[model samples]
Target: MKIYKILNNNAVVVKEHDEEKIVMGSGIAFQKKKNDIINRQKVEKIFVMNEGNEKFQELLKTLPEEHIQIAEDIITYAEGYLQVPLSNHIHISLTDHLSFAIERHQQGFQINNKLLTEIKALYKKEFEIGKWAVQYVAEKLKVQLPVDEAGHIALHIHTAKLGSGDIASTLQQTTIISEMIEIIHQELGMDLDEESISYQRLLTHLRFALTRIESNEPFQVMDPDMLEIIQTKYAKAYTIAVKVADYLEKEYDIQLPSSEMGYISLHIQRLIT
Candidate 1:
């Protein structure tokens, strides 16, 4: 492969079989110019540049080569740990996030991930990878990042695992769930134990509820008789569920089905009683 563009001393864009590819290695592009043939022996990794990836191309040009390498290494670890192929956009999104995170840390800034507890409770596997990544970065860059940063990284890993490349949606879902949990606490007037089975069940229900709404997948429709029975028997829980439904509709423009509310009310009743 011949060099089409040099991103840095260790990375370059090469042309192979009429396709652009990113090639990276130590000193791979040293003293090399455009059109120079890459030393095949020195090549370590070859990435087929995705078409219409202008953002990734620009990221390669501007981000420090070491940061990109760290991002790639962390991604490789995450994939191996999960035993799944992540979305290609994780290359762009994770690298961008990692870069910004490191820069902020160096400038003595801290970002608190408010969803840390929810993330750790919900995304255990991804959060484990995030903890490892924080230790890895601390060793590599000598920067001790806060555990909150691990939660942020876990969200990135989870977003990649989902193959959606939509971090905003993932964060929004986590945020909505957290808020809904708070609503339950305030409505029921109790400090719900996070480690309890009831709390876990509630989290699972809310997670699936959000997933159902987002995908527009229908759940088992409740009959009017059962719905009425639940509404009458668990009046407070049903009312809280209705408030949650209204909040979702008003804040996120997501209209939860009546059947879904019925299910949510059952879960809330279990939690409260």
Candidate 2:
């Protein structure tokens, strides 16, 4: 592996002779400008780097059609998800996931079922995201994940975690729920009962959960046993409000907003719990 360009001290760009692919790595620094000598110790991971430049074009030649296409899909999908435009930061996570998807496909790994019904229910938009990713991979690596295949993979990524890993650690219960509950209690004053306030907060939390679940973000319910009890106790409101998240997931395909999900889930908690 030869040093090509250093992104920063934490990252570097290099070319690998054996694989003949352009790669990027972390914990590396460039000694010179664009064209400079790179120290071997600085190299982290030697593979292809994404940039809409000559380097990207050169790197493409070394990749198979499938890989190239998958890479492209990863790029487009990432841009939308991250809300980041294409630049020197080709998004390490996105590229890594694409490579994983492509390799798994090549090696004949089965696609795991994660959010199948949810994604298929919101088929149009989800498929649009999937199509963009599939086309990008096809064009870049000349490989394509079937619509359903890509759908499963994409949903898997969204639902996973907050970080780069496959299992995303959803942020836990925040004081916000309790605080909001207090606020509502105070706002309702002597006119409303304490139980009513609790119910409101429970619904709120469920609404919040809806958003998180839809976005593949991590969310926490108040308590499981308590929630189930409420579901049995307050069957009517519980059933109606419970449908809020289901309706959104099935109808719009997009998750409810955080605030909305919180309110909804909170209400559900008050009822069943």
Candidate 3:
């Protein structure tokens, strides 16, 4: 595609099928001008400038070329390591975050990550990638970012992996899951073994349940007889599930249907028993 505008030596805005796209590569635009044809083989990343993503375009234009390169490199590594195609919005979100984070670090600002422990426990793979990302930035940019920054970066990666592009919703989901586990511990009066299989199962169930709740998707209808049997068999577990559900509703204004609660109760039963 021909260059519509040059972002830097490594990136340029190009038009294809009448849609604007930001294409990046090593020296892709060196000695090039507008209307120059891009070398397809040299192109490493292509971001479609879709509607409602004007900020992405502006960021591409305004952020330092090196910062954008770092974001692209991290995104490439994350996608390969996680084996998931992250939402393209990560290009905008991560680039913006990295630029701001580097600036903050340079200016003697320390942003504390309150959810560091929870993030490490809940998002193991993403957190691993986040750790790698901070190290990568350090080696390239000569900056010593705090470990808490990895937690913050992991949340961004998790949001992109969900393909939601809503970091607030992802953060809320993480907080809810962490708190829900605490509710189970309090209501059932047992300390959970975070490394145990049952605990992992419980965590996975909570994650999917929140996804369904947020998407307004109903859980599969449990038969009334089976539901009643399980509730009766695991009365305490079911009660804790309801309490967790209530917490979600009251604290975040997120309503969890009874069917989802029933599913959560089964997971809770596994943990308690």
RMSD of each: 2.2, 14.4, 3.4
Candidate models: Cα lDDT each: 0.87, 0.47, 0.85
State the local distance difference test value for candidate 1. 0.87
Score every model by TM-score.
Answer: 0.89, 0.37, 0.79
Best by lDDT: 1
lDDT string for model 3 (1-273, tens) is 899988788888888788888888999999999998889999988877576357886786788888888888999999999999998788888999989998999999987887776788778888998899999999999998888989988988988986554899878877888888888888878788877888887888888888877677878888889889878998888888889888988998878777778888998888877
What is candidate 2's CA lDDT for residue 267? 57
Model 3 regions lying over 4 Å from their true place: 16-18, 35-41, 52-54, 162-165, 185-191, 220-239, 253-273
For model 2, the superposed segments whose C-alpha errors exceed 4 Å read: 1-73, 76-90, 119-127, 136-144, 152-167, 170-207, 210-273
Q: How does candidate 3 score on lDDT? A: 0.85
Q: Candidate 1 vs candidate 3: which has greater lDDT?
A: 1
Reference-based TM-score, model 2: 0.37
Q: Write the per-residue lDDT of candidate 1 for residues 146-232, one digit (tens) a residue.
A: 999899889998998764438899888999999988888898998888888778888888998888778878887999999999999
In candidate 1, clashing pairs total: 0
- Pairs in clash, predicted candidate 1: none
Give me the candidate number with maximum TM-score: 1
Per-residue lDDT of 56-92 in model 2, one digit per residue for the tens?
Answer: 5434444443444445446556557756444433433
Question: Candidate 3, residue 241: CA error in Å?
Answer: 3.2
Error of 1 at 62 (Å): 2.6
